[model samples]
Target: MAHRSFLPSARAANVIIALGAFALGWAIYVRYALLEQSSVGLACRTLETLTCETRATVIALFSQSAFGIAALIGAILQLIRPSLIMFTLALMATCAGLVVYNNNLAGLAGGLLLISFARPWRGARG
Candidate 1:
């Protein structure tokens, strides 16, 4: 009999990755909505209900979503490979996301996951 590792299975890892991507996507969408609303200026007046307070709410939502996605992607990638490069990329993406809307997280996580899962790199030498 062989000893089995306790880490999450591939299916579980994929699910976590998908969730992180969704959070990132949602955050980007919220930011886009806020920007579009602000740029149009008087468009809010036509609605009669939109207000400055909503912008603050959207900003807060973006922050939380960004944090969740970053943390999830970072944690999951570390679990999958324990690579410093991957972790650094995740951290950078998360930090950059705070200042601007970017789709880097999805690409980074997706690429890392694909590479990590497509072939086992554990204990391989450069």
Candidate 2:
């Protein structure tokens, strides 16, 4: 009977998550501690040039709001369904972009990389 044969690899999952968390944390720390804060504004300015000033501002604002919502929702999902991990990851990507736009390459790179590798959805897959 296909009742239960293979249980998820809790050890592996935990290890992945731990490492991912560490990577993410270190990334953020490096950004704030090592890199000059002014880089953030430069990142934002770089985003601004891609489009017209007026529209760019609006898009940036909307993205910021979405980022918050996504993070909140993702957190809530943690209790009910681990699958939200992917949503959280996607949101993290959005946040990273904003960070980079704000001239924070460290945050953008580290934060995004953390979630992508972590894979919260792993356990929730079943």
Candidate 3:
């Protein structure tokens, strides 16, 4: 009798991918929503500073959006075909997003999925 490793199935992977998509969507939505509601607060506080408020806002927005987009793409690819490349990309994107936006929950979820999916287990072997 061979021992079986606890690995997620394709269905589980799909679920994880869906969750990642949701996270990506929420991140984008929330960031934009906040900006729209309180553009001044999100901008730089000092007017005399070298860095302009508008410039800071644009940079932050771009960084967050780019990270979310990359993660979303990676998640979509993983859903279509589970691969190490896709998993790594997704993990990296999620980490970057967390660093930029301080989104702990999304980062943890995405990281867990990527780590679990990357490993070779009984059910994941396809």
> Among these predicted structures, which one has the highest lDDT?
3
C-alpha RMSD of candidate 1: 8.3
Better of 1 and 3 by lDDT: 3
Any runs in candidate 2 off by more than 4 Å, and if so which?
1-8, 22-36, 39-63, 83-126
Clash count of each predicted structure: 0, 6, 0
TM-score of each: 0.38, 0.32, 0.39
All-Cα superposition RMSD per candidate: 8.3, 9.7, 9.7
**Candidate 3, residue 117: how far the Cα is off, in Å:** 2.8
Candidate 3, clashing residue pairs? none
Ranked by TM-score, the better of candidates 1 and 3 is 3
- Model 2 lowest lDDT segment of ten: 1-10
Candidate 2 TM-score to native: 0.32
lDDT, candidate 2, 1-126, per-residue tens: 123222236765575466546545643543453343565445656565432353345446444654444444443443234443443353454453343233243244345434443433434334
lDDT of 3: 0.55
Global lDDT scores for all candidate models: 0.52, 0.43, 0.55
